[model samples]
Target: MERLTIDDMKSIELEIMDEIDRVCQAHGVQYFLGYGSLLGAVRHGGFIPWDDDMGIIMMRDQYELLMANFNEWRTTERFKLVSYRDKSSIYQFAKIVDTTTVIFENFVGKKAATGVWVDVFPLEHFSEQQGPALLKQHQRTGLLRSFAVADPSVGTNAFVKLVKRIVCPFVKNKDLYELAERLDRIALRMNAADSASTLVIDVLGEGKLEKMFSKDLLEPIRIPFEDREYFAPSGFEEYLSIQYGDWRTPPAENARPVHVMEAYRL
Candidate 1:
């Protein structure tokens, strides 16, 4: 593995997409482009030149099948599947596991924190029998409410997981984002690392690292390196007002920067 520049990252993104497509096609598992990948298709007819992650949706059964054959897929290109389920702790607010990102960081021998990696979000569809129909329906209502609202009464954490499994598909990039923020807030408040990590897992499950710090705050637009393009959470421009103040781009001094990769062991 080598340190991936934006160009290198994009090239890798295509290869990963092809691998997922091939595997899903072979298994009869249905998947859809998610997050930046889907947004790219809609906004740029491809990846946002600066975007560096990839995500997809599949039912739990399909995810099981994919995990079962993960070893076979590993040979496709030296990639690794990273999931927080494997490592959730009360000690840390959050963590991202990246087979490729960790390797890339080491190869580059750089000290900067790097979040460059791919994420696979599992899509869990819900029916009235399984989850609150209103919450599921709320996804289509307002993006903000759909994302930030959480039911604190559900104690097992199973309920929230069920919500994520079901509701993520119906939302847009903006909505997807709002949902992430809301979940993060609930997790932090309840100290429910299990549920919180599971939620974050959806965003960066397969080795890519994206932040899930404050669910209330929106992530900033990021330009990882010189000559590379800029990327932000989907529809970042729309939420800039509430997140960073006035919608107009802020001065560099007032803006927060997106964290990338940091070469170190957990």
Candidate 2:
């Protein structure tokens, strides 16, 4: 097997995005390019030069609709949608994976394996009053996630390393998987439509509570992405400004980091 180069990774990601676009359009399910993927679309017109992944988000309703019809809509021979409901899937979120390729990341452990993929996030409704409860739930989920993956090499600092070493011995992978299911339920319950704010609950590791935005911001608008156009939040500028102040400016080369993953074309 040969490792994929940056160009190869980008090519595969574009394929995944195209398929997602096709399914969402056919079903009238709205989705928006988000996070770093949005940043790249607006600034670089594609994946950021150093970015290796893509992300798209849909509101809870659209997300659920997509999941309900996923098997019928998805190209089974080419891609598969993996979500928390799948026993081998570790993340609470969903991923659209290319079946004829392989992309392995250490954080996913052994049970789950998928090829080059794009992350599909659900924007959960949230409210200011729910902050404390959300934080507590996130903490528990975060701990379970860490235990499930349990890579001692993850941290560089002594304090972080020591904490992982201490906790690693006590948590079993099976227990972690079971706890993740409970966390998923809690997350689903928190997504009340009456709330004024919204968050991507599966992105808890990114301090998502602070990343929350007004539900009004979710109204979709089309924007250019790579040579094609895709939807983004109508208030994307406001959302981006909050998540990354002065998002128009490119980061320093050294500051532009991509997650570590090994990819190969089948």
Q: Whose TM-score is greatest here? A: 2
Clashing pairs in 2: 45-226
Assess each prediction's global lDDT (C-alpha) against the native: 0.40, 0.74
What tens digits encode model 1's per-residue C-alpha lDDT throughout 141-255?
A: 3344333232222223677657654654443233333344444333233222233223222321221122222222223233332223333344443323322344343346434
Query: Model 1 segments beyond 4 Å from truth?
Result: 73-77, 84-116, 127-259, 262-266
lDDT digits (tens) for residues 55-128 of candidate 2: 98887778788877876798655877876675536666678888788877754454556778888887776645
User: Candidates' TM-scores?
Assistant: 0.42, 0.89
Best by lDDT: 2
Candidate 2 global CA lDDT score:
0.74
Off by over 4 Å in 2: 106-108, 157-159, 193-207
